[model samples]
Target chain A: MEDDYYSIESILAENQKIQCTFKIDVPDMGHLDGGNERDIKALSKVQVPLWMAYILIYSDYADFTIPPPFSARVRSALNAEARSVRLSNLVGQAGLWYGFGRMIMRLLNDDVAKEMSDVLVKTFRDRLPEVIDQAQHFASVHASSADSGVGGDNATMLFREGLDGTERELFALAQDSTRRTKRWYETSERGRRS
Target chain B: MALPTPLRASVTPAELELIASEQLVEIVPLVAMERTAFISGAYGPLRPPTKCKVPIWMATNLKLKKKCRVVPPDWLNVEFLEGRLTQETSEAGFSEMPFRFAEVAKVLLDVAPDDFPNPDKIRSLLKDIREARQAKSREGLSKLDHSELSLPNLCSMEINEIRPFFIRAMGVLTDLVKEAQPQQDAP
Candidate 1:
């Protein structure tokens, strides 16, 4: 609920769509559903941006189904092996699986919100070590490849492809730090000699 | 135009190295010089063949000019690092390491490889220690709690490496906790 107005990431995450069923007749909102009708009817299901859906749900005007990305099937897949699951493919265009899940948690009741948040936290924890390992591995490869002109790991790239937005950012951060340290180690002597 | 982003959640490794350079190191000067005043503090008269303590930055500068030989820190040797590596691998929690070990070791090894015996072996040992410690840190992160994360004895570089991820993860966790709070109060 603490939406930082300046965060582009949060804005992009809010752009994801969720299915909401209107609880009552709504006037002049048919454009939302792309229907010819001038107004949305009661119990009508429509896909709305997450931001708008949150507003509708918060005001008790609509009820939203849990998105397929956070469905029981995904939960089982994550429980089986979180690192292997392709979280990048789970969410909408933003690929903000954790971000989206956190937003959704805000609209749910206590028990369901707790359960969903647990899944989000567990998935993050399970996959974080791999994220760090891959970042470090690629960093070392990059440092050495600059001299040897060798190619990067294909399997690592395949694994990296499955990272969600949050994980991607974390990977980039870890990679940048490792790269900076390696550069410092390799270049400090030369820079001084010159 | 590319506007600058907000401040980073943690200091970069380079910045940490710069800070670590303030730590004093023993150096044997090949050329004699009178006691000199530096912005940080005064360093004593540099008589030839006698070891004197000076900040790492000054030592590295003098060392680069081949005017001094750096005395590698007590723990910078192969045997000590190998022992620490074993402790790191065998322990559940992080082993006690110097707070600025990573930065200091990297700077010293890079600047004064000839000063330390078997520099390559020392480098490999240090790398092994780092890997072992990193694996331990990752295990700690996997057990991360929403309310708190207690990891003692983490070095500066390791802490900085995890800072961005930790801050964001904690933010997400706090948000989730907040979400569940309102419902608990509703009854």
Candidate 2:
């Protein structure tokens, strides 16, 4: 997500669909495909959801022109230099940076990927660490200085009334489990000894 | 294929939580539940052959009574999970998988290792993938920036190691998004 600054959600929601033609028949695989039950025949053009197209294309099922998003063009226009980290993040923020980058990387096997694989690698390699650096820097501030807005808000930020991402919830649960297990183990062991 | 909403292209923090919480196992009642009440909540008037989502404790209770066929979650089979483990290890990104896949697999292996064709192999493979993913996470954490940090080719266990960074990132992300949002009141 941070790679280029794009979220998968934004990419999936905002991106336009393109026509793709299958190289093989995609039999009725499952219900997730929005009720397209019939086999997608080879050599026939079908308008596909870009997300769906991504899967099919990767699996060697079909092909399409994967349009470089505006974020892609931003990176391309800036000569792929480190000078444009903030600029690219600004633009990539519009579309979720690394997501678009990773999506393009996923397309590396596609014909287009042949020409600019280097750009994709450099796009991430050069810029990604910096992106992480920026976040980590901010996180560091948030972690230490209580006067910082992020730091001061930490308690309320957590335990706020809303759904946290799954991992946060899970981590808390794991800690809770560990505490219980330790208590039980200590109690049982003490009982056994005494 | 894209996993359902709760699923992700990679192993996520949720997977670990789900595993820790323990996923439901399929239980076929040898005797009718007949709307029986239990501590967790109201359970079946469940009939035979129909599977009920039962906790491990309850499932064991049923087994003791010889009351039901306790079919493990679908991923219990060695054949099915071996394929998933292979994908987790090999694929650049993984398909959506159940939340507590690794933990459930562990439980099933511990409880009924006999059910699987190759429980030991599955155990070892899962461990290797986990270790490899943890290494990647050390690399990933050194470079963390976003809420959705892609644990490329990694597993959920690694997510636990880096939860603090991600949680902070998420908080920052929400704030950034709010800041970035154009005010409707402005021209």
Candidate 3:
């Protein structure tokens, strides 16, 4: 019969020195239901180094350099395939509000976060018509160009023409996830305020 | 089979060659002076009163191409280049250094019109400076020694003093554009 349990005694180990790089101060929680005994506990604290934060922020999109992962690849491919759709131009307008929503959430609660997320989603959805119209116009302009060979009639075609249904669904899912994160942050803030 | 003989062609009539004349525009390159000669009155006892040089580059158009010519007669002696203005004297081993074009633009753009000779001229000068720097950079190599480059002291000054100037300049430019829009809209 095979042995069911692994013994820690048989495991090899090496001793190493560990040094703490950062210190975080947490509020002391006094003892609850104590019988004339003073007990103080420190709240849990996590320390993230400046270098690490810089790396994480710079490395990933939707932070500073690039849009969220969902929009990044889509935007790049679209830009390459069609010259008229400039993904960067949308950032200062719609993306700025989206970022604000995210910031408000991280500073606040889950419920308020969700509400903010809903607001952002609704805003984006409302603007979707304009966005689609702009995209179509750009496509037509490119298609009309002599080098494009594509006719103006086919220029207004959306990503659905090239991408499968699953891919389009995935993009929608990613966008929803981004919105939910923002909503969660807003909710957290509202909870704190209440 | 034998090859057939080639037929000879004959000139039927004399034709007149018409030449079209068009005006050729001659592009004249603009020469702008760069670099400033500063005569500082003795304020400190460390060294005798001396003349310090500030190098400047002015960007101008040469026909179809934009060219940058170095201004301020003795820029190499001043040891000024882009990027390294903020380093302390102790760290940099120099009392003064040159600032980047961006930094200089930020400073000049910040200075109040009341304090400077001519604010608009200064702004233009700063733009030319920036253009020159950019043109030089795009040339694939830097003219100055990279290791010795430094930023000017003016840029390292308080941001508050400089920030408002840029805002004002931007506002003025925006107003100009707004004013021009109506004329453009007119039939």
Candidate 4:
């Protein structure tokens, strides 16, 4: 699904950078590293966009390392408590952590790919319940406050700030449904009064 | 411009309520009337003080004009809803309810609160039941997997509330699963 051409999320995920170590000397591509050198030296590391890295890595031009978002520290942190990790901060500004991880998984070999994919799935599964709870909580809070804005305590705001793109979408969906249900309840009561 | 949020694929609570209005309800007529025909079906030869089975929309229309009294469905009472609430809180799964129970109950309680005994208590009981069920749904979602999730006896309104979340979550799961499969096959 991340491969969908029309999906803006997928596009942003592809635009994310992946650090690759060059296996062959490539002239004129030193600009990728923002260096003045005319040729990218063999064994030199350079950060390339995920989309371009996919081709270069497959065509035997480079070998990419796991990006900082999926590093061992993040892995253990996720294992410790998946809900507390701030996924939005992990993937820089776009906050497409899951999508970026999936794209990176596609570029890896078998055993490592399986491990990375499992992390993505487990993190998403672990955090989903909390995401949904906050959405419903905010929905009711929004309803009762009656245009007082999307009101919630500091904890909820802090938690919401941690959501990745996919979880953000799910949160929006759940909040919307709850709001509609609240509106329906109110209108039904109005119908009774009239 | 894109379609409004509620109009996108999933059914809204209001739309579900409209559909629930088609359900047949028993009403006590104040004035006699001949059988009437409509697209859905023909409903009845209502007689004074005599009961007739008509769709809820017609019942609401007649009740609004002071022509009839709606007979609340059997399960709308506080006693029955309280029983369901106990079952919902005690059980791990959902209790069986009328397929459109939420929508129908809201419509009935809205259009004809006077017909039911102790409408306030019933309303509060229904709210309690809903909260219990929602808690169960969240628990179910916590165990969600890429393969399947079975939540039997969920009513229409409950299903609609979680539909979008479930669909998108499953989509992501499928993507993850599909990515993992080829790796296992290759090695």
| lDDT of model number 3 | 0.28
Deviation from native of the Cα of residue B121 in model 4, angstroms: 1.3
| Best of the candidates, lDDT | 4
Per-residue CA lDDT of model 4 for B90-119, tens digit only, reads 988899899999888888887788999899
lDDT at position B28, candidate 2: 77
TM for candidate 4 is 0.94
Which is superior by lDDT, 1 or 3? 1
Instruction: Name the lDDT value of residue B182 in candidate 4.
Output: 64
- As a whole number from 0 to 100, the lDDT of residue A67 in candidate 4 is 98
In order, the Cα lDDT scores of the candidates are 0.81, 0.48, 0.28, 0.85
Rank by DockQ (best first): 4, 1, 2, 3
lDDT of 2: 0.48
iRMS per model, in Å, is 3.7, 14.3, 33.3, 3.4
Which is the better candidate, 1 or 2, if ranked by TM-score? 1
Fnat, model 1, is: 0.43
Tens-place lDDT per residue, model 2, B42-155, is 666668877787765566556555676667566555566567667656764544555445555554455455545676777776666555544455466445443456654343
The residue-by-residue lDDT of candidate 1 on A141-166, one tens digit each, is 88767656433467556568888887
lDDT of 1 by residue, B1-187 (tens): 2422213676667788889999999999999999999899999799997899999999989998999999999988988888888888887878888999988898888889999989999988888888888777778767776678888999888888777667666666676554423653331
Looking at candidate 2 chain A, the ten consecutive residues that score lowest on lDDT are: A185-194
Candidate 1 C-alpha error for residue B125, in Å: 2.2
Q: TM per model?
A: 0.86, 0.36, 0.17, 0.94
